[model samples]
Target: MLPLAAGPPFGPEHTMILEQAATALTLARLTSSPAWDRRAHSSVLLDLLHWRYRSRTEARLRAEALGLPTTGHRLVPVVVDHPGAPSADGVALTDHLASELLSSGVKALVGDLAEGRSGLLLALARASAWQPVVERIARELRAAFGPDVVVAVGPGVTELGQVTRSFREAEEVADAIGPASRDRPFHVASDIGLPELLYSLRDDVRLQKYVEQQLGRLVQHDARHGSDLLDTLRAYLDAAGNKSIAAKHVGLSRQAFYQRLHTIERLLGTDLESGAQRTQLHVAVTALESLGPPAELG
Candidate 1:
C-alpha cells in the first residue's frame, strides 16, 4: 500500500483541488449575484435563455424550485422590454441581454411592440422560420389569457438587439389597431397596412357587422366546440397532417371530428386538407379569434 496520505483515501492534494474549484465557482456566482442561477433558479435568465436557447428550462427549474406549482405548462415567453422602444440604457441592456442569449444559443427573436412601449418576449422556437412561431405563440397566449392581453412578435434577428424596434413596433401597431389589436399575432413593419385597416375597422360599425355576419357562425362553432380549435389546428399542422391526434385533443371520435372539419370547411368554404386552403382558413380563423365575440350583425 502507498504510504498513509495526509487526509483520507483521496488525500489532501485532491481534497484541496476540489475545494478550490468549488470556491472559485461560488465566488463567480456571487459576483454574478442576484444569481439568475441560469442552471438552478431561472428569472430574467429565462428570458436570456429564450433569446439564446429555444426552451424554458431555467424558468421551469426556477419556478419549480420556488414551489410555484405550475402545471409544468411552459410558455415560450417572448420578452419585450417595457417601453417597447429602447432608451440609450435600454439599448445597452438589450445588447447585453442579446449577447447573453446568443452565448446561450437562442435562434429567433419575436416582437413588434413599438419603441417606448412594452418589450415583447417570445418563447424560444424554430418552427416555420419566424411567422408561424409568432402566430402560434400569440394564438396560444390568447387561448390561455383570452384577448385581455395582446402580444407582438417581431421577426427573427440573426444579429443581436435588432428586434428591439420590432417589439416596439408590434406594441405601437397593436395599440394603433385598438379593438382589432389581435388580428396578427406577430406583426412586422411590413404588416402595417393590416393594422391601419384595423384602425379603420374599429370605427366601422358596418364592417364589423359584415365580419360578424360572415364569420360569426364559425366563431360560435369554435367556442361551443372548443376555444382551442385554432391551437389544435396549429398543432395539427405542426405535426404534418395527423387528424387522429387532433381528434383526440378535442375529445371527439375520429368520425365526429371529421364531421366538424366538414362543418368548418363548409362555413369557411375552404379545404383544410390542402396547404393553400389551410393557409387561408388559418388566417381567417386567426382573424376571427382576434376579433372576439361578434355583436348582432346590425
Candidate 2:
C-alpha cells in the first residue's frame, strides 16, 4: 500500500497517480517473493532450453536478469530422467536439486522438465571444468533419487542460443542408453562415441538407405530362410575379422562358419576379406542396431 499526501489544490489527477503508485508497490512485493523467483527461474530456463527467445539480445537480457553470465562462460546441459513414480514431494524437487547444487558450490539453473525428468544448465568459467561438475551432479542425483536414475550430460556451448542443441543431445544420449543405464547410471555425450553420431542422423532417409543398401540382401535372406546369418555377421565383425574367434562366438565349427561367410559373400556380393568392405559392413550393422526400437528408461 502507498500513502499519499495532498493539499486542497490536489485534483482527480492526483488520485489517479496515487492508485497507480499503490498498484506498482503491490506488484513489486509479489515479484520479490520467493515463489515468484522460482517461477521466473523456471520460465527463463525453459526458454533457454528450447531457444524460445526472439533474438540473442532478448535471450542475453533475460539470462542476465537472472544473474546468469551471457559471456565469458560456457554452459553444459545435464538431464536426469527417472522412470519411476514421482516422489511424494515432487513439487519441491526442483528446489531441492537447486539447493544441493548450490551446496556443492556449483552454479546452475535447474528446472523440472516433466514428472520424472529434470534439466540443469551449469555455467562454468572453463569448458574443461564440466567433467568434474557433471560427475558431482551425478553423485548428488544418485544419492537423492537412488541408482535407478539416468544422468546424461551434453556437450558444452559458449552461446546461450546453442543451449537447445546441448539439451537435445543430452535427451538423445539418455534415450540411447535407456534401461541399460541401470548398470551405468551416468553417461556423457562424448563418451557415447559412434552411436552419438548415428543418433543425430538416425532419422535421415540417407542413413536408412545406406543400411538397406549394405545389409538388405542379407536381412531378406535371414527372414525368408529363418537363418541366423545376420547374427553370425555381427559376431564375425565383432571378433575383428578373426575367423577362429568369430566361429567360436557363433558356436560353429570352422567349416560351418566358413560356409556361412561364403553364403553372406554371395548374397551381398561383397568380400569380407577386404578391410574397406569390412568397415562399411560394420558401420551398416551398427546403424541397423541404432535404428531398432529405442529402449525406454526406467
What would the per-residue lDDT of candidate 2 be over residues 45-148, giving only the tens digit for each residue?
78877788766767766666555676888888888887772452563556777777768776677777766777888889864667777777677667776777
Residues 176-280, candidate 1: write the lDDT tens digits.
444444465554456555435555345456556655654566666666766544455554554556889878866779897777677766866657789876655
Model 2: how far residue 241 lies from native, Å:
1.2
TM-score of each candidate structure, all chains considered together: 0.31, 0.66
